[model samples]
Target: MFISDAMAQAAGAAGGENVLMQFLPFILIIAVFYFLMIRPQQKRVKEHKNMVAALRRGDNVITSGGIVAKVSKVIDDNEIELEIASGVKVKVIKSTISTVVGKPAPANDTADKK
Candidate 1:
């Protein structure tokens, strides 16, 4: 007595339209997240990678920990030595460097010639 042929036919007819309407908000939210959050974060990471890869000795830099220092030497593809004082130095991961604060002075041939 509870089952009806008309009720089954109506649900079948509305299934496609109703399913899309129900999930439309979910699709919109995902699109919003990708544009507003994911895209900018990915761009920043790319810039950071390029900056770290271009590090050279004598470039003054700031670390992620806020330590300001100069690059004394590039130890490898992933590490470097930072001189924070006349003699004090620290070995840090390249990725830990946040910004290049100073440019290395231009090379002077006369100084070396003397």
Candidate 2:
């Protein structure tokens, strides 16, 4: 008669709701990471895909290798001919290009010389 009722004590203890509350912070942390890290990364990948798809001849671009060049020819879907210097050219894969420099404004200086 003096024995403790183990089954009654176990049934009365905090259960599923208490366990879920303990993990609530961990769930929130994962949600924050997805929005702040994963989402932006995916968006940038999409924008880069669009930029690469829109490549055309005469676009002044910088490559991932840090070389700046102008697109001399669109060889095919996979390769391009870049003109790095006058009469000097190199064949590079299309994806090797990184960023396109914005077109320069028209020069105000005239060709007339004294």
Candidate 3:
């Protein structure tokens, strides 16, 4: 006979090494994403939460809306009173505060004031 039978390729063992090797790139990608993106984002969120939690009176902050104000009073868990201008104030959500620009440093009585 001139035609020969086509033999099938041999299957790999079921030890799972081949499966792991096939998925190694995906696992690495996920790990890289976690380290490069997810972990840093979580860290930033934690830092932001801590910063917001530590917010108090006299802390100069910039709102996400680009308004510069001082924390005149922390009204409640979710709201704060901001002194946007002299004798002018406004209420805002706590998380809307973006950056604590100037934290009021404690005054040292021993130092001479010029």
- Candidates 1 and 3 compared by lDDT, better number: 1
How do the candidates rank by lDDT, highest first?
A: 1, 3, 2
lDDT of 1 by residue, 42-112 (tens): 99999999999999999999999999999999999999999999999999999999999978889899999
Off by over 4 Å in 1: 1-13, 107-114
Q: Indicate the worst ten consecutive residues by lDDT in candidate 1.
A: 1-10
Q: What range of 10 consecutive residues in model 2 has the weakest lDDT sum?
A: 105-114
| Model 3 ranges with Cα > 4 A deviation | 1-7, 12-15, 112-114
Which candidate model has the greater TM-score, 1 or 2?
A: 1
For all predicted structures, in order, the TM-scores are 0.81, 0.76, 0.86
In the range 1-114, model 2's lDDT, one tens digit per residue, is 334687678768978999999999999999999999999999988888788777887889999999999888898988999999999999998888889885444555665452
lDDT for each of the candidates? 0.94, 0.86, 0.91
- Model number with the top lDDT: 1
The whole-model C-alpha lDDT of candidate 1 against the native structure comes to 0.94
